[model samples]
Target: MTTIEAPSGRTTTPDVQHIDVLVVGAGISGIGAAYHLQHEQPGRSFLLLDALDERGGTWRTHRYPGARSDSDLFTFGYGFKPWRGPSIATADEILAYLDEVIEENDLAQYIRYRHRVTAASWSSEERRYTVEVTREDTGEHLRFTTDFLWMCQGYYDHDKPFQPNWQGMDEFRGQTIHPQQWPEDLDCTGKRVVVIGSGATAATLIPAIAESAKHVTMLQRSPTFFISRPKVAELAATLRALEIPDEWTHEIMRRASFAQGEELWRMSVETPDALREFLIESMRPLLPDGFDIDKHFNPTYRPWQQRLAAVPEGDLFTALREGKASVVTDTIERFTETGIRLTSGEELEADIVVTATGFDLSLFGNVAFTVDGEPVDFTQQVTYRGIMITGVPNMAYVFGYFRASWTLRADLVSQFVCRLLTKMDEQGTPVVVPQLRPEDADMPLLDWSDPENFNPGYVMRSQHRMFKRGDREPWTHHKEYTEERDILPTADLDDGLVYRR
Candidate 1:
C-alpha cells in the first residue's frame, strides 16, 4: 500500500488505498488471482475486495434448497488444491473447498469484505487507475489507486432472476419463489408446487422438493437434456487406493474427466445424433412406462449446443418413477387465481411457484470504466486473448470456459496474469495494454459467444453488452481446454501488447 503525508505540522491520514495490484471479488477467481500473485510476484502489495460479506461467491449467495454445481468438482477445483470428494459435489462442499484454498494460501488477511467497487478509470499520465469503492454496511465511498486491476466478478445479475410478466401473476394467492432467493423460514411440505423452467436449477429442485411436496410440476417452454451422473468416482477412489500423491491424483482425475467431456462434445459437434441417442437411451430405463423422452427430455438444439442437466444418482428419474413430479412443455399465457394457464389451453394447480426461468446477465457488475476520463465502451473494444480488452491498460477479467467447469479457465487466467506480471517486472515495464494492429482495422467484431448456435439463454441475453471477438489469433476463444492449455499459460506477453517503462 502507498503512504500518505499531511501538510507540515498536520496529522497524517491515509485517505486513499494504494497498491501495486487490486483484485476485485473474493470468490473463486479473485482468490485464485491473489494466490498466484503472492506466489509469482512476491513483495507486491495487493488487496482482495468483495461486495458480499463472505469469501464464497456463487455458493455463498445462492441459498435455495438443492442448489448445487452442475459442473463436476475435479475440474472445478483450483489447480493448487486437490478435491477429495466425489465429482458431483454440493454447494456446501464447494464452499468448503474454497475456504480451504483461502486458508492454505494465507489469503484471508488481505481480503476486505463488503467492499463494492463502483467504478474504475485509467489515467495515462499517472500510469495508474483511480477506483471508487463503497462499503455496503455504511454506504461510505472510498478511493483507491492501483498499478493493475484484476476482475474476478462472475456474470449475472445478483439482484433478481429473470422473470417474465404474466398477466395476474401478482394476484395469485399462492406463494412465489425464485431459486436464487429461497426463503429460510418457508415450508414446502405437503403443498402443491410448480417449478417454472427446465434448466439446471429446476432439474435440481424438482427431485429434492418432490420428496416433500404434495406433488411437484416442472413447467417449461422447452426441454433440456438430462443425464444421470454417479455420485461416487471409481477412478478417483482407485487412485487414492493405489497411494498416488494428491497432486497426481488431481491431475489424473482432471485429465480423465476432460478427455471424456471432450469426446462427448466432439460427438455433439460432429455426430449429434449418436450422442443424443446415447443420452436418451441412458434415460429410458430410469423413467416409468410410456414416459415421453421426446417431449420432456429431448431438446431441439443439438447436444453440447447448451450444457446438459445432470442429476445426482438419478434422483430426478426416481422422482418421475415414483409419480411425484410431472413435466409440462408449454408456455404460461397468464397466471390464474389458483395457479397458471398454459398457452396450450391447460390449467395447472399450485400452492407454490418457483420461477427457475433463468438469469439476466450483468457484465462487469454494471461498473463503468473510463480511460483518460473518457468512457470506454465495451462494444468497440475487442478482447485480447479473451482476457484483456483492447486499449485497456493494466487490467484483465476472468471469463471461464462455457463448455467446462468455470475454474479451469479461472485457474489458467490467474496463471497467465502471473506470468505476464513476472515478465513486466523483469522488463521494468509497469503498464501494458492490448493494442489492435492496423492491419486488422477491417476486421468485423462479433459477439464473444456464439449464442445463436449455442442457445444458452444467459449468454444470448448479455452478448450485446460484452466485448467483441475476431476470427483470428488472440482475438477469439475456443472451448477446448487443451487448446487453452497450450496457449494461455505461456503465451508471449510482448507479442501484441503495448508496454510502458
Candidate 2:
C-alpha cells in the first residue's frame, strides 16, 4: 500500500493509509455502496467512514417520538434486501433492517465510526484525494488517500436544525425542543405541548406525543397535503399467505409500489387539479366533521409541489378526530411567556414547545473541498447526471429523490459507481473528471432543481449554495425515477467524462 504524503510541504507519515476507494458516511447509502463494491469489485480495497458512532445516519440521529419512514419500506429499503415489515415502519424497525444488511453481508469489518471528514483535497498529479478527518472518540486528526471518493453523507445539517427566530423566543418560560436534537429524557406525559410546523416532522410528532401529552396543538402558518394509507401492504400479505418466496414477494411489492408512486407523480404533473381534489377529498372523511379541511389540510401550492406526507393508517387524523390533538392555522405574532401569540390576538398556553420546522440543507456534508490546492466553489460548477460534479475528479455523491424513496436512487448511484470503477480498472485509468462538451458550452445554467418542479423549503433556502444544472442531458440532475431507472443503467460513461492515467 502506498503511504499518503501529508499536505504539501509537510513530512510524509508512515501511518497514512491509501486505498482504492473511500466511501464516506456509513448510512443507508454508504452501506449499500459497500455491498456493491464487495460484490462487484471484490479485489478493490475500500473503507467506510462515518462521523457518528452508529450506522443508520438519519434513523440514528432522529430520536423524536414516532420517528418513522415517510416512504414505504419496500422502496426505501435496499433493492437487494427483502423488506418483510409493514409498508410504513418505525425508526427502530428500519435500523434493525440496516443492521441485518450489515451482519448478513459482513460489512462491519469495513466500517470505521466516529471519524468525521473535515476536508478533502484532490491531487491530479497523484491521482488521489487526501482526506482529513477528526476522530470524535479521541479528538485525534488522521488522513486517508483514495483513488475514488464516494460521498454518501446526506444533504441535511444534522447538527444545526433550522428554527426560525420568533419574537420573544428567549423570554418564553417553557422548554423549546427541535426534533433533530430531541432530549432523551424529555417526557411529554401530562404536559400541554405546542408543535410549530405543518410538514412531515410535525405531522409525525403530533400523533406520537398526543396520547401522552395533556393536550397537543399543531401550529402552522399554512396547511400541507397529506395522504393516508394502510400501514401494511395488502398484496405483500396475500403473497406471503400463498407461501411465495420472500425474495419474489419483495420484488413484486417493490415494483407495485414504484408503479403506484409513478401514477401519483404523473397525476400531479399532468392533472394537478384532479389529483389535488382526490387528495383533499380522500382526507376529508378521516378528519372530524365540521373541521376546516381547507384551513387545516389544504395547501395553496399544487400537490407534490413540496412533498406529500404519508399518514399511515391515518394515525395523525385519528389523533385529531379523537380530540387528543388540534390544528391551529395562523401566523405566530411572537412567543409569549407561556407559549405563542398569534396574529389574530389569540394566546396559546403550553408547558413545552416543539419546533418541527425542518433543517438546514448541507451540501457534501459541509466538508471543505479543494482541487490542486485551489478551493472548490460548487455553486460555480455544474453537476453531471446529479452524481458527479463537473471539474471534481474521481468523486460521486448520492443525492436521493425528494419525490420518491431516497434509497432507490442510492441503489442506482451505487451500481453506477461500481460499473465506472470496473471500467477504469480495465482501461488502466486512475483519474476521471466530468467536463462540459463544446456543444453544451452554451447551455443555459439553471438552479440545482427547478423550483416549479420541486421546491421544498430546505432546497429553496439553500439553492444558492448548491451546484448548478444545465438545460440538457448529462447536465440535469432532477429526473424522475421512472426515467432514471431506464436511463442510468445504460447511460454512456464517456458522454461527459474525461479519463486520465
Candidate 2 similarity to native, TM-score: 0.97
Model 1 lowest lDDT segment of ten = 4-13
RMSD of each: 3.5, 2.6
Task: Name the regions of candidate 2 deviating beyond 4 angstroms.
Answer: 1-14
Best by TM-score: 2
Q: Give the TM-score of candidate 1.
A: 0.95
Query: Against the true structure, what is each candidate's TM-score?
Result: 0.95, 0.97
lDDT of 1 at 391: 85
Tens-digit lDDT string for candidate 1 (138-228)? 6666789999999888877776778878899988999998888889887899999999998899988898889999999999988998889
Q: Which ten residues in a row have the lowest lDDT in candidate 2?
A: 4-13
Residue by residue across 194-286, what tens digits does model 2's lDDT show?
999989898899999999999999999889999997899899899999999989999999999989999999999999999999999999999
Give the Å shift of residue 279 in candidate 2: 0.5
